[model samples]
Target: MKPVDEYFINQKEPYQSIMLYVRGLILNTLPEAEEKFSYKIPFYNCHNKPMVYLNILKGKDYVDVCFVQGILLEKKFPILRNDNKRKQVRSIQLKNLEDLDHENFIALLHEASHVLSHSKKAWFI
Candidate 1:
């Protein structure tokens, strides 16, 4: 199995389901996104640039869907949180699939892609 698949399969209940659901939302929204395992987690790349990543931080109860240039996207998406004090990376934490705002999350994904397409500098660097 692909490492990305294994990463999802290895996760425990609730978290595993949450990650899978978020993963589907991401792929369905950005069909061109490339899914790869990086930093031991699932990372999505768009237009050949890192766009987002998913992970369940140690001791954290929720799955983190982190946008690479979230700082810029935050102007439009106040839902994105920087609770960890990350400068550019902002994320939404999902404890259950019910917590996901489908329309808003998909819109955020599209916005993040837009931000990536307009910027020339690599955001992930």
Candidate 2:
């Protein structure tokens, strides 16, 4: 299996289901996204920017749908984890299937893609 596929296959129970659902939401939202393994996680490249990634936090029962340009979108969707320690990245921690806010998350993805596409900064990843 591809290493990225293996990443999903190895997950247990709720995390597996949550990750797969988030993966589907992200891809369905941004069909141009390029899926790859980066930093040992499933990273999606979109609009020539490091758009998003999915991974389970160590010792946590949740999966993170991390947005690379999250700082730009967080004001509109404050549900994202607000870590002052994290400058640009923000994440939505999905602990259960019920936590998936399809409409808002899809809006966030589209907004992130728009911001990244217009960014003049050299792509960092």
Candidate 3:
């Protein structure tokens, strides 16, 4: 199986389900997105640039859906959390499947893609 598929399959309950659901939403919203395993996590690329990634941090109870150009999206997506004070990346932390707002997440995915398409920042993997 693809490592990305294994990443989801290897996850324990709740986290596994949450990641799978978000993964589906991302692919459904951004059909052109390329899924890759990087930094040992599931990363999605848009416009040939890194756009987002998913991971369950060690000792954390939630799955982090991190937007690469979050600094730009943060202005419009106040729902994104900068708890870690990451300069460019912002994330939506999901503790359970119920925490996901499907419509909003989908919108965020699209907005991220739009931002990447217009960005000239020379962002790397």
Q: How many pairs in model 2 have backbone atoms within 3 A of each other, for residues 3 or more apart or on separate chains, i.e. clashes?
A: 0
Question: Which parts of model 3 have CA positions greater than 4 angstroms off?
Answer: 122-125
Candidate 1, residues 1-125, lDDT tens digits: the string is 99999999999999999999989988988999999999999999998888999988998999999999999989799989998999799999999988888999999999899889988854653
**Consecutive 10-residue window with the lowest summed lDDT within model 1:** 116-125
* Segments of candidate 1 deviating more than 4 angstroms: none
Number of the candidate with higher TM-score, 1 or 3: 1
From the highest lDDT down, the ranking of the candidates is 1, 3, 2
Kindly report which residue stretches of model 2 are placed more than 4 angstroms away from their true locations once superposed. Answer: 122-125
Q: Quote model 3's TM-score.
A: 0.94
Could you estimate the TM-score for every candidate? 0.96, 0.91, 0.94
The lDDT values for all models are: 0.91, 0.84, 0.88
Return the candidate ranking by TM-score, descending: 1, 3, 2
Q: Indicate the residue-level lDDT of 119 in model 2.
A: 84
Going through the candidates in the order shown, the clash numbers are 0, 0, 0
Among these predicted structures, which one has the highest lDDT?
A: 1
What tens-digit string does per-residue lDDT give for candidate 2 at 1-125? 89989999999989999988888888888999889998999999886668889978787778888888787778998988854367678899888989988898888888888888888752443
